[model samples]
Target: MSEPLLEVKDLNIHFFTDEGVVKAADGVDLIIERGKTLCLVGESGCGKSVTSRSFLNIIPSPGKIVSGQMLYRQQLPDGTTTTIDLAALDPKGKDIRRIRGKEISMIFQEPMTSLSMMHTVGDQITETIRLHENVSKQEARDRAIEMLRLVGIPKPARLIDEYPFRLSGGMRQRTMIAMALCCNPTMLIADEPTTALDVTTQAQILDLMLELQQRYNMALLFITHDLGVVAEIADEVAVMYLGKIVERADVDTIFNAPKHPYTQALLHSIPKIAMKREELDPIKGMIPNPYRRPSGCAFHPRCSQVMERCKHITPNVTAIQPDHTVRCLLYEDMPEQVTQKEAMHHD
Candidate 1:
C-alpha cells in the first residue's frame, strides 16, 4: 500500500466529429504503483489505447482530453519530490517535453510505423538517448550499442548500422524495447507491444519486458486485450468498456472472483486449452457505436445480469473491499464500505 507512482482520476477524452462528440474515455480512473504492472484490459476500441495516449499528451487530431487529473509523483535529481498534474500542462510546453521521454516513455503498438524507416536502428536509439541527455555523438552511439545488447540483440556493434527493415519481427520489437529503455525512464507505457507477434515470440517479448521492468524498478502500464498476458505480467487489472473502467482489482482476484459482468464475460471468452474451438463462448455483442451509446449503464444491453434499473440509472463505482471495486448495481447493497462518487455516475 505504498504511495502510487501515478494516479489518473475521472479522465475523459473525446473525439469531435461532424456527426457528434465520441466519448472515447469517460471518467476512467487508474493507479500505477512503483515497480509493478497494471494491465488495462478490454476489447478493441474500448478506449484502452486512447486513455494511455493521453498520459504522454499524444492524443491524435480531432481527439482531445476534455477533463481529468493525471497526478504523477516525480522524483527530482536533487533528492526531492514534486507532484505534477500532467493533464493541465500544455502538450508542447517545456514541462511535458522534459517529462515525456526522460521520466515517462511509451512503446507504441506498431514499431514498423513508430520507427522511422529512413533511419537505421542505431540512429533511432541514439536519437532518443541524446534527446533527454546531454552527450557527445560517440558517447550516444556507445550507449545505443549497450542498449541493443541489453535487449538481447546479437552483435550489437554490427546491427547498429542496419535498418529496422533488416530485422525480424521479434528483433524489431526488441529494438523498440531498446529505444524505450535507453533513457531509463521511471515508468513505461506499452500499448499492446506483443499483439503483432507469434505466440512464441509474444512470450519472449513479455519476459524481456518483465525482466527490464525489474532491472530498472520501473512502473509499467501495459495496455492489451489479452487476459492470458495479463495473468502473466499484471500485478493489478482494470477492465474497461466503452471508455469507462468497470472493474479494478489485483490480478488474482480478477481471475478468481470477478465482480463485473463485462469482466466475467471477457474471462469466459478466453479460449481454454481443453475446450474445443467451436465450444468457446464469446461475449454476445460487439462494442456499441460511440455516437449511439446505450442509455443508463452503457453495458446493460450486453450484460447477462442486467436489471431494470440498469437500463435507466447509471451505476456508481462501489468499493466492495479495500483492493476491489466494481461499477454495477448488483454490488450496491454489499455490506462492505462503498466509496461512491455520485457525480461521475452518468450516461
Candidate 2:
C-alpha cells in the first residue's frame, strides 16, 4: 500500500472540568490516503466530532491533548520523506498556523459560526487566502471565486459578494467547502458538514466533495455519525465509541462482516431505503456518558455479544483481515484456558 498522507497515532484529547478530565478523544489511530475519504462513524457524543476537531486544534481551552501524535508525511524539497508531527507543535507556534490552512484545513459543523456576518462571502474566502499566502488582493479574489466555482456554487462571481445570511442553507455549506479548499491543503477535516441540510442537499454536498476530492487528490477525514453518509461516500470507515476507535475496515467489509458487536449494531440501526418504517430497527440504549464511561470495553454494556471478560478487560485491536480491524474479545487469540472459559459460556 502507498504511504499514508496523514497518520494519527494513539491520539488522546481531554477536557478539564470541576468534576474531572473528560476524555473526548482517546487512542484514535487511523490513516488517510491521498484522494480517498476515510470517515469516522458512530452515534452522537461518541467522539467522532472531537477526533476531527482535535486535528485542527479547535478543541476548546479546557480541553487538553494528553498524548499521541498527528503525523503528516510530505516530500521534502530534496525528495525525502519528512514527517511533521502536529501534536508536538506549540499552539502559538508559526508552524501550526502555516500548516493549519496551507497543509491542513477544517470545515466546522456550523457555517454561521465560522462565517463572519460582517464580511461579504467573497471577502471571507479571500481573507483566508491572504492569511496564508502573500498574494495580491485581486489574486486572492480570483482564487476565492475559483474555489467557489470548484465546489459547484452557481454564478460564483455574483454569489461571492453576498453575505452568509443571503445564501440558502445548502449554499452556505458550499461556501464553507469553498473556504476550506481555498488553499488546496493536503488534508481536509470536515465535521458533520451536512447536518441540518435536507436529504437532497446532503446528497448534493457529498457528491460535490467527492468531485473536489478527485480534482485535488487531497486526503479527506470525514467526521460524521450518519451511516447513510458513510454508505454514500466513504472509501473506508472507522467506528468510534467513547473516545477510542473500535473497528476500522473498508466500507464493504464494515457493512458486511463487522467483527465488533457495536459496529454490527450500528449498521443494523441504519434504516434502509427499501425497508418500511414499521420494520425499521434502531440500536438499543444511548451512548454512555464520557465522564462515567464503563470500565474495560466501553461498548460492553450495549454489545449483545459481550462476553464476561469484556466487562473486565479492554480488548486490544486485532486484525481479522488485512483490511479489517476490531477491538473485541471475540476476535482475540485467547489461550486454551481463556478460550475454554469463553466457549463454555457460548455453549
On lDDT, the candidate that comes out on top is: 1
Indicate the residue-level lDDT of 21 in model 1. 90
Pick by TM-score: which candidate is best? 1
TM-score of 2: 0.93
* Whole-model Cα lDDT of every candidate shown, in order: 0.90, 0.85
- Per-prediction TM-score: 0.95, 0.93
lDDT of 2: 0.85
The lowest-lDDT stretch of 10 consecutive residues in candidate 2 is: 338-347
Compose the digit string of candidate 2's lDDT tens values, residues 129-186. Answer: 9999899999999999988988888899999899999889899999998998998888
C-alpha-based local distance difference test score of model 1: 0.90
Off-target runs (Cα >4 Å) in candidate 2 are: 77-80, 336-347
Which regions of candidate 1 deviate over 4 angstroms?
Answer: 334-347
**Candidate 1's TM-score:** 0.95
